[model samples]
Every structure is written in C-alpha cells, then in structure tokens.
Target chain A: MKKIIFGIAFIIFFSFLIVSAINMRTFGEPTYSEMDDYFIENAQSETGANNVVTSVVFDYRGFDTLGEATVLFTAVVGVVALFRGVKK
Target chain B: MIGNLPYVAVVIFVGLGIYTLMFKKNLIKIAIGVVLIENGVNLFLITLGYRKGAIAPIYTYAPSGQAMVLPTPQALTLTSIVIGIATTALILSVAMMIYKHYGTLDTDEVRRLKG
Candidate 1:
C-alpha cells in the first residue's frame, strides 16, 4: 500500500517536471542576461583577470567561495572524525 | 524538441535520482541518488546561462565579435560541484559507520535493529 502510494506520487511529480522542461525557453537563448553582460564587459578591466568566469568566482564572489570552502573543510573533518579508530 | 534536449536531460537525471532515493534500500545507493540530483542541478545551472554563438568568457585575445556565456552560473556551478563532493564524502562515511555498527546496509534491517 505504501509503495503504491509512493509510486503514484513519483509518477505525478516526474510528469510535471517533464512538461516544464519541454516548455522551457529556447536552449541557447537566455531571456535576461544584463548582469552577465556587465560582468563580461568590465570583469577584465576591474579585476585584471583574463578569464571572466575565474574573476567572478574568485574576486566578485569571494565571500561565497570562502563559505563554500568552509563547508568543504567541515565535511572533510566530519568524514575523518567518523572514520577515526575504525582501521584497527 | 531538439533545442530543449538539455532541459529534458536534466529532468531525466533528477527523476532517476529521486527514483533511486525512494526505491533503493541500500544506503550506498541512496548516497548515489543524492549525487545524481546534485549533478542534475549543476547541469541545469549551466544550461541556463547559454548564449547563441557565444565563446568562453575570457578577455585574453578573445574573438573580435563573439558573445560570452554567463559567468555567474559557471561560478555557482563550480561552488556547487565542490559542495556536492563534500556531501557525497560525508554521506558515504556515515553509511560506512552504519554498516560497521549494524553489519548490514539494508535500510529495513537497520531500522529493525535500532536499539
């Protein structure tokens, strides 16, 4: 009974997802890209970085990257702690 | 239909992930499901930032008149990939601990042995 209910719900959810994906805007054309335009235009001048994507990741959004690094460090610590004393 | 292929691929990825999460009983399989969902999300972000006839977003001798794909989504996807690696590592480690304690990876058996 539980499995049947779950199956029905899953099917319904996936149908919705498929419908939306098929209806999405054209693949190569994004609707609103002003922010990206600005970044591409001025990232090299402002950050002196040849790669705009690199500048955006490391300089423009430095704090977000820092937070991501912290999360990765924490996960590493957690995994190490969990495995402690298991090799013996 | 051809143009919307990437989005459909993303949906397929996420749908398979969800199915694995809901139907699989093994902890390792569930961890794989989580990773699948993460990859699907990263792909979606990348697909959202495309521009027709665009080249890489680099300023060092780039083509004279070509556009560049969005940089923000690429940056966010890099962060997400790092985060996904962290999450997958943690999940596998926890699954290992559970196997060590309960001597089984089956969710039903693990639940029954809870004490």
Candidate 2:
C-alpha cells in the first residue's frame, strides 16, 4: 500500500515537472537580461570589483548578505541553546 | 526547449529528496533530503542564467566584446549555499538534542518521547 501510494505520487509529480520543462524556454538564451548587462557594464567601474558576482553579493546586495549572516547567527544561538543544558 | 533538458537533473534531485523525506525514518536522513532539495533549487537557478559563448562574470578576463554569465543567480546561489549550511547545522543540532533526550534517532521512536 505504501509503495502503491508512493508510485502514484511520483508519477504525478514527475509528469508535472516534465510538462513544465517542455513549456519552458530554451537554455542559455534567456529572454530577460537587462539587469545582467547593467551589472556587467557597471560592476567594475561602480564597485571596483573585477568579479561581478562578488560585487553583486558584497556591494549591490550587501544588505541581503547581512540578513543571511544574522540568520546564521540566530541558528547558531538556537542550536547552542537547545544543547546547552546537556553535557557529559 | 531541448537545451533546457539539463533540468532533468533538478527533477531527479527533488524526487530523491521527497522520497527520502517521505520514506526515511531517520531524522538525519530527512535533513539530508532537505539539503538535497535546496541544492537542486540552486542548480535550477544557476542553469537559468546560462548563456551561449559567455565568459565568467569577471572583468579581468572577459573578451573585449562578449557576453558574461549572469551574476545575480550566482550571487543568489552563494547566498543559498550559506543559508543551507546554517539550516543543516541547526537541523542536525536539533537531531542531536532529540537523540540525547530520547536515546534514539528514529523519527517514530522520537515522537514517542515523553516529557
């Protein structure tokens, strides 16, 4: 019974995925890339970073990275709190 | 459409993650499955940014007149990877706590843990 349910769900899920893949646009030929162009042209001059991805992460999107760091800090605190009471 | 076929990998990863989450009884294994799904998503995003005849998004090596791979997805993937690490660490630590309290790592057994 478990196998039967799993098999059915898998088929349904895969079929959906395959259908979407077929409908999606071709690879390597994105329809929208204006932002990428803007970033590439300006990243070096604006941020003085040779690596566009790095500039985007550390300069353009620095706030997002800060939030991510905060999340990691919170998770570390939570984990420590969870296990703090127990020790050998 | 045909070029997008690489996404079959993303499909497989997601399927494997779901299978593990549904069938695996070990809490650590379920955490692994969650990580797998996160990786698959990151792969899909990176794949979407692919461009033909493009160089890496670095100004130093890019040819005088050429396209570069999208930087945003790569940045997003990096962020996601960092986030994935923190989440996995948190989940595993919780699993450790559960094991410490219940003396078992099996989800079913852990659920039977009493106060």
Candidate 3:
C-alpha cells in the first residue's frame, strides 16, 4: 500500500519535472545575461587576467571560495574526530 | 523539444538521484544519490551558460573576434564542486560510523536499532 502511494507520487513529480524540462527556453541562447556580459567586458581591464573564469572564481567571487575551503576543512575535522577511537 | 535535451538530461539525473535516495536500502547508495544530485546541479549550471559558437572566457592572445561563454556560472560551478566534495566526504564518514555502531548498512535495520 505504501509502496503504491509512493510510486504514484514519484511518477507525478517526475512528470512535472519532465514537462518543465521540455518547455524550458531554447538552448544556446540565454535570456538574461547582462551580468555575465559585464564580467566578460571588464574582467580583463580590472583583473588583468587572461582567463575571465579564473578571475571570477579567485577575485570576483573569492568569498564563495573561502567558504568552500572552510567547509572542506570542517568536514576533514569531523571525519578525523569520528574515526579517532579506531586504531590501525 | 529536442532543443531542450540538455535540460531534460539534467532533470533525469536529478530524478534518478531522488529515486535512489528514496528506494535504496543501503547507506552507501544514499550517499551515492546525494552525489548524483550534486553532479546534476553542476551540469545544470554549466549548461545554463553555454553559448553557441562562443569561445572560452579567456583573454589570451588568440581568437580576437569571437564571443565568450558566461564566466559566472562556471565560477559558481567550481565552488559547488568543492562543496560537493566536502559533503560527500562527510556523508560517507557518517555512514561508516553508522555501520560501525549498528553492524549493518540497511536503513530499516539501522532505524530499528536506534536507541
């Protein structure tokens, strides 16, 4: 009984997802890209980096990278703590 | 319909991940589902910024008269991949600890053994 209900729900949800995917905007043409355009135009002048993507990662959005680093550090600490009691 | 194939692929990725998360019994499978969803999201991000006939967003001494793809989404995807790695490591370690404690990886048995 529960399996049947779950299956029905899953099917319904998946159908919705499929419909949205099929109806999405055409590929290879983005609708709103002003920010990305700005980044591309000014990144060279501001950051002097040949790679705009790298500049965006390291300079434009460095804080996000910092947060990712912190999360990785925390995960490492947690894994070490969890396995501390085991020997060998 | 065919134009949106990449979006459909992304949705399929997420759907399979959700199914695995819901129906799988093993803790490891659940972790795999989580990883799949993260990968699906990463793929979606990359797909969003793709431009037809555009080059990479690099200002090197080449390809002077061509457009470039979006750089923000690529940058965001990098952050997301790093975060996914952290999340996967933590989830697997927790699953390992659970197995050590309960001697089983089945979710049903783990639930029953909860004290």
Candidate 4:
C-alpha cells in the first residue's frame, strides 16, 4: 500500500516536471535586441578568422581557452602522478 | 530544409553523451561519454559555420563574391578535435593505471583516493 502511494506520487511529480520542461524556453533562439555590427563587420580582419564562434573562442577569449587547457593538463598530470604504479 | 539536420544531430549526441556520463559506472565508459560530448560540441561548431548554399572557404577554385562557409569554426574545430583526442588518450591511460592498481574498471570499486 505504501509503495503504491509513493509510486503514484512520483508519477504525478514527473508529469508536472515534464509539462514544465516542455514549456521552457530553449537556447537556440537569438535573444540579442541589438546585434553587434562591429563583430560582423571586422570579424575577418580583427580576429583574422572567418567564423565568429572561433573568433569568440580563440581570439576574443584566447586567454580563457589557454587557462582552461592548462587546467585540464594539470588535472591529467595530477591523476598520472597519483596513480603511477601499483599491482592489482 | 534538410540543412538543419546536423544541428539536431549535435543536440541529440550531446544529450546522449551526458546521459551516458551520468549513468555509466565504468571509468572507460565515462571517458567514452566525454569523447562523445566533445564530438557533439565540435559538430555543433561545424554546423554553426555552415551556410545553406556556400562553398568551402578556399578561394582558389571558388568564384569571387561567392558565399563561403566560415573557416574560423573549422579551424577551431580542428584544434578542439585534437584536444579531445589528447584528453581521451590521457583519460584512457589513467583508466588503465587505475585498473592496474585496483583490478577493476568500475569507478565505484576504485576508492583508493576517495576523500
């Protein structure tokens, strides 16, 4: 009896969640009220890249990408150093 | 109309990859899931640079003033794919080390470094 009640409650909760998720806004639609014309105009010359996303990732935010790569490298190194050699 | 299929594919691949990462218990499976996610992201980047009717960014054979798919995303995707390969290799190597140490690939069983 208790299990049945719990199952029913779970179904109701999941139904609500599914409905809400269906109504949620997705990220694909562009929301910018005013598109940056400068980015579109000088993307090639300033960034020296034909893709805007690449310009955003490599040139505009190159330092951030560098830091991210460094962090991942450090994590790998740390993992390797920690688990160097031990017989199973 | 069909040009948007790649974008949908990216989303589906990313969603499945995340699901695998969250649900899989084996360290190797998790590593594979990460690779899948990286591939999905790269595919999305490529799709974003795609124009409905555009030639490759190369200027040699293309006519002047012709639309060209953006080259920057392709370059970035190349770099990202290389990074993803490196990461997958490193993770697999670590997983092998872990297996050697623990005799198991199940992440839950390898609890030597747990806090």
Task: Name the candidate that leads on DockQ.
Answer: 1
Query: Once superposed on the true structure, which residue ranges of model 1 sit more than 4 Å away at CA?
Result: A86-88, B112-115
Each model's lDDT:
0.93, 0.87, 0.91, 0.66
What lDDT would candidate 2 get against the real structure?
0.87
Predicted candidate 3 versus true structure: per-residue lDDT over B23-46, tens digit per residue: 999999999999999999899999
All candidates: DockQ: 0.87, 0.72, 0.84, 0.13
Summarize candidate 2's per-residue lDDT along A2-83 as a digit string, tens digits.
8799889988987788777677778788899999889988998999999999999999999988988898898889888887
Worst 10 residues of 2 chain B by lDDT: B1-10
| DockQ score of the complex predicted as candidate 1 | 0.87
Q: For candidate 2, write residues B38-77 as lDDT tens digits.
A: 9888998898888989989987856868789899999988
Chain A TM-scores, candidates in order:
0.90, 0.81, 0.89, 0.55
True contacts kept of each: 0.93, 0.79, 0.86, 0.03
- Flag regions of model 4 displaced more than 4 Å: A1-88, B1-3, B63-65, B113-115
Residue-level lDDT tens digits of model 1 in A1-88: 9999999999999999999998989898989988899999999889999999999999999998999999999998998888877675
Score residue B76 of candidate 3 by CA lDDT.
93
Candidate 4 chain A, which ten residues in sequence have the lowest lDDT sum?
Answer: A27-36
Per-residue accuracy of model 4 over B1-115 as CA lDDT, tens digit each: 2334555566667766765776678999999899998998898777656654666665345566755565556757766776787688788888887787789998678887777
DockQ for model 2 equals: 0.72
Candidate scoring better on lDDT of 2 and 4: 2
Selected candidate, larger DockQ, 3 vs 4:
3
